[model samples]
Target: MPRQFPKLNFSEVDENVRLLAEKVFAKVLREEDSKDALSLFTVPEDCPIGQKEAKERELQKELAEQQSVETAKRKKSFKMIRSQSLSLQIPTQEWKAPSVNPVLSPATPVLPSAFLPVQVPYDVPEFQRVSISGDYCAGVTVDDYEQAAKSLVKALLIREKYSRLAYHRFPRTTSQYLCSMRDEKWKVEDEVYPDFHSPPEENEDPYNLDDAPDNLDYVIKIKGGIPFVYDNKEMMELNEPRSLPYPDLETYTLDLSHVLALIADGPTKTYCHRRLNFLESKFSLHEMLNEMSEFKELKSNPHRDFYNVRKVDTHIHAAACMNQKHLLRFIKHTYQTEPHRIVAEKKGKKMTLKQVFESLHMDPYDLTVDSLDVHAGRQTFHRFDKFNSKYNPVGASELRDLYLKTENYIGGEYFARMVKEVACELEESKYQYTEPRLSIYGRSPDEWQNLAKWFIKHKVYSPNMRWIIQVPRIYDIFRSKNILPSFGKMLENIFVPLFEATINPKEHKELHLFLKYVTGFDSVDDESKHSGHMFSDKSLNPDLWTSEKNPPYSYYLYYMYVNIMLLNNLRRERGMCTFLFRPHCGEAGSITHLVSAFLTADNISHGLLLKKSPVLQYLYYLAQIPIAMSPLSNNSLFLEYSKNPLREFLHKGLHVSLSTDDPMQFHYTKEALMEEYAIAAQVWKLSTCDLCEIARNSVLQSGLSDKEKQKFLGVNYCKEGPEGNDIRKTNVAQIRMAFRYETLCNELSFLADAMKTEQISALSK
Candidate 1:
């Protein structure tokens, strides 16, 4: 009924209303006929339109929430942009080429007043070539001549000790008196089928008849230096070895000619003795008998060669050891010819057997254990046999004393400065012109290039003094990080142009010195070894240099050697080097820093000695220390193990320094490290004086100028007057309080006493 009513009104409606009504009518008609189209306007028949709209809203909300969650997640996950500063500018100029200044000649420093009026020992041209013994020829005594003669006699006696009586049985050459009697008597028989005719016996003199033989015998004697003659035969048995005496050899004036005949070509012990006897007889050379005293057991072999007091090029030390008197005699003789020559020239020519024997009797260089132990080598002379693996022991308390007495004068601050100076020397380096010129073991080429570029940029940004970076490698394998940039192709843009502009020819020496200083291979390992620079091209697995090429010019090595000797002596005197660790950082590392460092005294000293080019001295000194302390030959791993805490170095008498080997990398200025040491020692229960000694040793081991050394020894730092004792006393008291150790207190007392004595000595001087 409602649809019929709407259809009747559809055409009668106004235009706007009629269109609406017609649309309504058409919609009604379409809805009535089309069941599929009716559903467009209707929600699900089972649900209300409001409910459907609510569900649609819920769906829209869900979609919006999902998009919001995704948007939020994206925002949360995005990373922030980052920017870093890159320094780039003029390449490092330290490696730059030089330009000529206004002055064309090289600059020279004027001699200071102290160095002026220089006097060298002698000029090469004005020197004479006089013989060493020429001036002292009259110094010999009659006793010397007698001793020389006696030496020859002694040799003859020794030969006679082995002689035996020999009787040749022939048909009795001459039957003196033969009698034939019928009752009782003797009969004489003749040979050759003929009756033997005997000469009548002659009556003997009453004095000689008692001992005279029935047969004819003869005796002959000659004056001094003469030969002997025997019965009817010219048997002048010379005192020569096994062979018949020189034919017709007869002595005359104890001349060199007669002695030369016996000793000129023979290896007989008598050769040198005979020659010495002749010389003594002629020159009276016994007055020059100054020789080193040696114990019988410790005495060196007597066969050592000694030149006459006239030879040149004689080593002073050898002379001191073998025959100091002879050396002095020679020196006295040559004083006029080359008065200024510090040492005698060694003669390459050899001595005769007689000469060898003469020295053997005197053995001037032989050092007895007693003599050397007390007065020459350290009081404690320890000889280690490398062939034997026995390790000599040192007491802990003794080592502690040494640690307490080390040199602390350089202090932390000045020590840092010295390190800084050493590093500064490398600042002026440039890239090497050669390929692979840098170390393969140090910073790699990439690292260096980065550094170079960074350095240039840094300089441009905030130019100041150049960075004085120290490049000392800890081990041989750590040298791969020292490369410079190539032309702009790699290693950032900074290295190439910078290297091209700054590099020069003469700078190679500086580079080498710097590299050597950093790499710790400036010298050879030993004189016996060779440089074999060829090793530079191959893998660095072999020994690189010998001790000869890298001689120690500094006294640091000597000081270190002395320290080791001192430690050994102390151990023999007292007991050990130390018993506890100094202050430490944390609980992680071992508490053996002080002990390990103390043990390193030998190695450190060895390194220092290598600087001096005294391989013989080094070896000699090494022989004086225990083998356990030495890092010789191929025993590095052993040395390292001995240094380790796990190894428990039972033998502990060692003297060492806790040095700031490479302070820059440790982020410690020398002074700062020292301060830390002081703090740590307190925390770790270490002795104060022990720390002081470590500081002192650092200074003592330093290569400081003499004036600097004086300052470091506390000679100049203390008050000028005895009245200043108050301050020193107060300081000592404070240290005692802080350390609270009796040993430290005792060391301080000793130091005070030493200082007083030193001051007194200085005043007297």
Candidate 2:
């Protein structure tokens, strides 16, 4: 029999737990001052009396445990098991890649498995392994250990549920352990991954619309914020919607509250804090001992190194995809060649490129990277408003609209040309890819159709680029201007058209074609802005949210997750590509934002706030959720480069990759992605193996199709551990891979053991 988990109902939860969640929400809202908010999320510099007392008490408890004979015996046993169970070795046989057809509708094509057995050319040299021979629960009490493990496992289950519902990727290694803890068998067929359409072949036309599936004519309605699909208008009138799995708001809130309460739990925090420290120390020991051996292994591998490894710029904005210098050059060249070409209209008067510059009292010839004023500086630090203004060239919004926006008098021709130039450079590099975000403000239903028309008209499709749709969280601004009636309208305008296009592709051919290259969605805005509203079951639904006040970050994430979940289920049935909710989270916000993202996002960008919450950080590590970090971007907006946590997170075994958030503002080179890597490698003193490993993480986190990933990373890239790594292709050392794999397994084994102990205790009772 399959294991069944208990259902969560908000009303049935303990009152104390409910109050704790409320307290967390209230605390986040109350922290309006930047300094106070920062302190609330980060470790306080001035240790309070309560914290000091707690530390003293913990030290006394540790001293007492050191003197206990039973504790000593338990420690010995743990050491013996640790050494015997975790002895690392190279595999003699290659594992075959599993056929992962995540969505199996009749219209879906089954692609063949890309895996093929290949012998490793060089053996991974024997290296020192860090084995903890002492009590695994040395830092915390056994009771505390059990509590942390239970809470963590519960959190993973919550994430896995959401991931599978949306066809998101969850690590197979973690899934197997989860299955074992539940006393069930884990099968490859149970794994679900997001389906991304492969790029058109060289002989095929990217703009061909004849291949769209026949129209199903399904009816879609957004009653509140969630979409319901009906077979036809008759089914809709009868209120008989399709049998797609829709998320329940109450259940989601209950699960969210559970995670919220766990973050504040004393025992769990203590356990997680200790484990994170241990992970960092373990990596240090491994590096000191196996550093040379890992390098030696890399030295023997031929035709691959850090420079040649495929790296994806997983987080970048389309508006600022090019560097400031590139933008300046493009502007000058346009003025030099097409000065008489009509490019814009003001007050219904057509204006040429030269005339627009003349109206601004400037000449394109005089514009240098410095005079452009697009680059961010010290003044922009902690000032999102200032950073946003940097999007405009020379403090002029006219230039931005004419050059950066997708809709303009010239139909974004100038912007498309710049983007294509960037893409051409990437093609020349042959080892880089990017997922640039284009804005979809959800102001009207025509936004989708217009954007699709712009895409097709400009012929902006690039093999080295995958597009992401970013929804700016500016509902309050729109509501204030009376541009939107309610939040529900906004949600409808954003998603309803996509649902229609999916259900009737022939009628929406342009959108249907354009969506093939879009791989994910991103929620982006200034996270530091405070919204006093607390999201709960009692809060107003989207349709009734008529006030000018904006909802909180959690509110936005939950709704986005819901729509994406339902949309993915609908598309899966039609054999269509799905979207991943890769939100811009934890950049600079309340810790609660990270909590919401943990359950909703497939991965997140700029997770600097994780450093403050050890519990969430450990959970992120356990789940192996990929994070795209941009230190230069942070330096100009939130944190300093020297204080960035990317290096620390990397050392602690987090799935982190380097990204250039906005090359125009934060970078100074034509090869923006390479500039990002070079700076990170130099500042962090990263090794070749470290750089390659990060590059490998980027490919896995990106929206590239499975066929492309296999060609780049290796056929068995889907597998975990050293077996998954192909050094000849990835340039990552197997020794490093083995250490990472063993460490994760060791941590997971502890959780599995704790669950077993709980089961045994229940049986005894």
Q: What is the TM-score of each candidate against the true structure?
A: 0.19, 0.92
Model 1 misplaced regions, further than 4 Å: 1-653, 660-671, 705-707, 714-765
What tens digits encode model 2's per-residue C-alpha lDDT throughout 1-765? 111223456564555677899897777566554365334334643322238789889778778877877656555554454444444222223324324311111110101111122344323445676655555576676557767889999999988887887788888778877887787777777788899999999999999989999999888999879899999999999999987775677778888888899888888888888788889899999999988888977887888888898999999999999999999999999999999999988999999888999999999888889999999999997889999999999999999999999999999999999999999999999999999999999899999999999999989999999999999999999999999999999999999999999999999999999999999999999998867777887888999999999999989999999899888888888999999999999998688999999999999999998987888999999999999999999988888888899999999999999999999999988888889889988998999999999999999999999999999988988887776788889999888887787778778777776675643444334
Which tens-of-lDDT digit does each residue in 312-429 have in candidate 1?
1100010011122222233233333543322211165343322432433533234332222211112111211221111100112211111111111211222222223322322222
- For candidate 2, the TM-score is 0.92
What is the number of residue pairs that collide in model 2? 0
Give the whole-model CA lDDT for all candidates, comma-separated. 0.21, 0.85
Could you tell me how far off, in angstroms, the CA of residue 239 lies in candidate 1 after the best superposition? 49
Q: Lowest summed lDDT over 10 consecutive residues: which window, candidate 1?
A: 80-89
**CA error at residue 432 for candidate 1, angstroms:** 34
